[model samples]
Target: MKLRAYLLMLAVVGIWGCTFVLIKDALSDASPLAFNTVRMTLAFLVLAIAYRRHWREINRHQLIAGVIVGFFLAAGYQFQTAGLAKTTPSKSAFITGLVVVLVPLFSTVKALRPVGARAPRWNAYLGAFLAFAGILLLTVPAGSGVLPDFNAVNSGDLLTFGCSVAFTLHCIALGHTSPRIAFQPLALLQIGFCALFMMISTPILEHPQMRVTPRLILALAIAAVLATAAAFSIQSWAQSILPATHTALILTLEPVFAWITSFLFLGERMGLRPASGAIIILAGIAITELIPQPHVPTSHEA
Candidate 1:
């Protein structure tokens, strides 16, 4: 069970990590909102068909929870897809992985969650710290020594930063919701909300049009089916089996996968300073997860 959970988390992060490049490719023909809408809409249909007869699968509350979750997913992806057009997928991936860092921080928010629950462990705190350090290494530039020319104020980077923030919030929100809801219904409703909002947001933000090219079609199918649909399913399954901290730790490598994919497939180059910065960030994340844990006393000890 432990091995299966570990592999499941690995597969989820690996597949999700590479999606930025796919998004970049898919956006060549479709606008961000249009792209999101199509992906969610198609994924909705596919899942819906499978669960069509399973009305008893989810209650009304779960459906509502799913839709609410979907909205956050759409918001995060909308900015992320838009940002990927400007920044390299590798950088975006790392920046995006900051969600792991944000999860612990957000969990403490007075409004985000009840303080009644057991607090996260010291290792979780360290993971958040390492994750934040990695973000600084990658995103901050004025004195970071990585990109002298790296415009810290670039509109594109800021947009990607927005992506990071929204995604972080979404992941944190998932940490709360996933534990309570049934996975299938939650996923189905989540994407349904994403499709609805993105379909509307696309027209307001960008011209809603797509040129049907082989590459674009391929990209859309891959993202919608593989990344969005399959990835969501896998995440839901993995989250059910693994601790949330472990899931975040594994996902911390998302940027590494993104960086590698772009370097090999898209030939997006990261200069030495920035590349080293990414490595620093990744090292921090790994350490955050792999650090030893302190023993907890049982009731009998008292």
Candidate 2:
């Protein structure tokens, strides 16, 4: 079951990675908030039909959980989509991938003890460090230098950073809620609320605009069906079986996948530095998976 969960998550991240380029292309014909509202609404409709039987099963606990998770999910996408308008697809992906580090930190925070917080395994921290280093390398321009210039950070990067935080919180929330709720109801409700939130915010946040081109329709169909609906359903189920930190470590590969997709489909070229960054990210994931956990003495043994 654990191995299956891992594979499912890998597939989810791969689907999500491909969205970066599609979203970048789609944004050319629609406003960010407007695009998100439509895609999320489409996704919600699909899930609603599939989970129609589960509607009667939703209880107060599920509703509250859905709202909490949906809020973060909506915020994450809003920031990511808007930021993508101003940043390169690769840069936006790498920035959003920072959730790999944020998840562990937020999960283990002392203030979250009341919510069942616990320290992550040592490898989780080490893996996050390496993953973060790889993100830095990936973000630096090809010929810029060994390190990124912090002073040159743009508004788009900042917004994407917000996306990372929001996604980290979404992971944590889903981890806590998924185990207790039926995956079907939970997935449907969260997606429904995400669509609701985005729909409500689009007009207020930005002047909603969309051109009904073939490109827009194609992107929306792929994103809504595959990336949003199927991927999130898989996520809701997988998080029930995987620790949030472990789930996040798997997601660190998203940017690598995004970069490859961009390079292959969009004619973008990756430099040597970014290539090394991709390798380092893989090393980080391997460290967490390959290293054995240290045994702890039980109370009886102690």
Candidate 3:
């Protein structure tokens, strides 16, 4: 079961990685808000029909949780899609991977809260630190052979960083809520809320144009079905059983996958620094997953 969950996370990240390029391509003739509004709406419609039976299961708490998570999810996509337009797909992927670091930070803080719980396990902290170092190495620009030029940072990079924060919130919220709610209904509600938010925001914020090309249609369809509905549903179910830290570790592969997709589809190339960073990120994930965890006892235990 654990292995399957890990595999599912990997698959989801792989799809997401490829989307950096696909989304960049699709945005050529389409505004980010309109594109996201349409994709999310389509995803919500499909999930609503397919999971119609689960609608009866939702209650007030689940609806509120759904709204919270859905808002972050939609906002994250907005930042990411808009960023992708102004940045290279590879760079966008690397910046977006910052969530791996943010998740552990949030988890550590929660654990350290004076009233609520004990601190996080030491290994989680170590693994998060390693992942942070790896991301630094992986995202450094190839030509500069130096650390990221922060002074030269563009709007896209800032937006993508915001995307990371929003996604981190989404992941943590899902971890907190998924176990308490029915996964199907929760997933539907979250996506539905995102669609609703985007529907209202798109018209007001975006210029609203779509060329309806075959590429655009394909991107929209794949994004709505596979990426949003199927991937998020898998995430909801997976997080119910897996730790958020573990999920974040696995998701670090997203940038690597993004690099690969960008290479194949967008002719992007990597240098020694980025390559080494990718390897380090994988090692960090392995450290998190392969190491035997110290047990955390439940309240029912003696």
Candidate 4:
């Protein structure tokens, strides 16, 4: 089971790693919102066809919750996609990993107490710290002239920050998802909701005319089908049986994977500085988690 879970996580991470490049490429032919909407729409189609029978199982409450969750998901992608345009993949990935640090906070907010009914574990904190430190080194530019454009910000960096927060919230919502509802239906509903929001927002804010080409279409398909569907399904499956914090921590590796893949495929490279910063970020995150775990959670409590 442990191996399965880890492998699932690795697969998810690999798909997500490629996502940075895909998002960056897609933006050339479509607006941030449009790209997300179209991609999600395709994901919805893939899921819908696979689980046609599950449609009847989804209730009104599930639909409503799915739509709400989907909106946040779309928003997350919108910003991430936008952020990718201006920010380096390495920087964006590291920043997005902030979600790992936010989950317990959100859990606390919901319960009016610390999550896990205990302090974080020591190892988790150490891991988080290493990761974060690595990010800082990565982002501090090689020279003085690398200052970000203040007006638009790095669309990719800003978007990634948004995606991280929304993703954290989305995870919280998953705990509330009805067991009676199928994952496929709920996911489809959410994707549809995300697509709706993306399309609506695209024309209003950017108003950039898009000229779609074969490359654009191919990129969208990959993002929608492989990254969105495969990665998410695997993540959900793995986290369902693992400790939420542990699962969250494992996910913190995404930016690292993205940076590595981007360098290899997209020619986006991160020098030693930002790479070290990524380590720092990871270390900080590990510190936050590892510093507080008291005991194993009971199944009833989980």
Counting clashing residue pairs in each candidate, in order, gives 0, 0, 0, 62
Prediction 3 TM-score vs. true: 0.80
Give the lowest summed-lDDT range of ten residues in model 2: 293-302
Off by over 4 Å in 4: 1-5, 111-155, 178-180, 241-246, 288-302
Q: What is the lDDT of residue 255 in candidate 4?
A: 72
Per-residue alpha-carbon lDDT of candidate 3 for residues 152-197, written as tens digits (9 for 90 to 100): 5567867777887787777677667765777788778888898888
How far is each candidate from the true structure, as Cα RMSD in Å?
6.2, 6.4, 5.7, 5.2
Model 2 scores a C-alpha lDDT of 0.75
Candidate 3 regions exceeding 4 Å error are 1-10, 111-118, 123-148, 237-250, 273-302
Best by lDDT: 2
Q: What digit string (tens of lDDT, one per residue) describes model 2 on residues 1-302?
A: 99999998888888778889988998999999999999989989999999899999999999999999888889989998998888777778877766655555565565432254456678767867787777667654534576567666567867877887887777777767766887789888888898999988889999999899998999899899988888766776786688755765676678877887888888887678766775776666556544432211000000
1 or 4, greater by lDDT = 1
Residue pairs in clash, model 2: none
Q: If ranked by lDDT, best first, what sequence of candidates would result?
A: 2, 3, 1, 4
lDDT of 1 at 150: 46
lDDT of each: 0.68, 0.75, 0.73, 0.66
In candidate 4, what residue range of length 10 has the lowest lDDT sum? 293-302
Model 3, residue 218: distance off in Å is 0.2
Return whichever of 1 and 2 wins on lDDT: 2
What order do you get sorting by TM-score, best first? 1, 2, 3, 4
Instruction: Quote the positional error of residue 142 for candidate 3 in Å.
Output: 9.7
Best by TM-score: 1
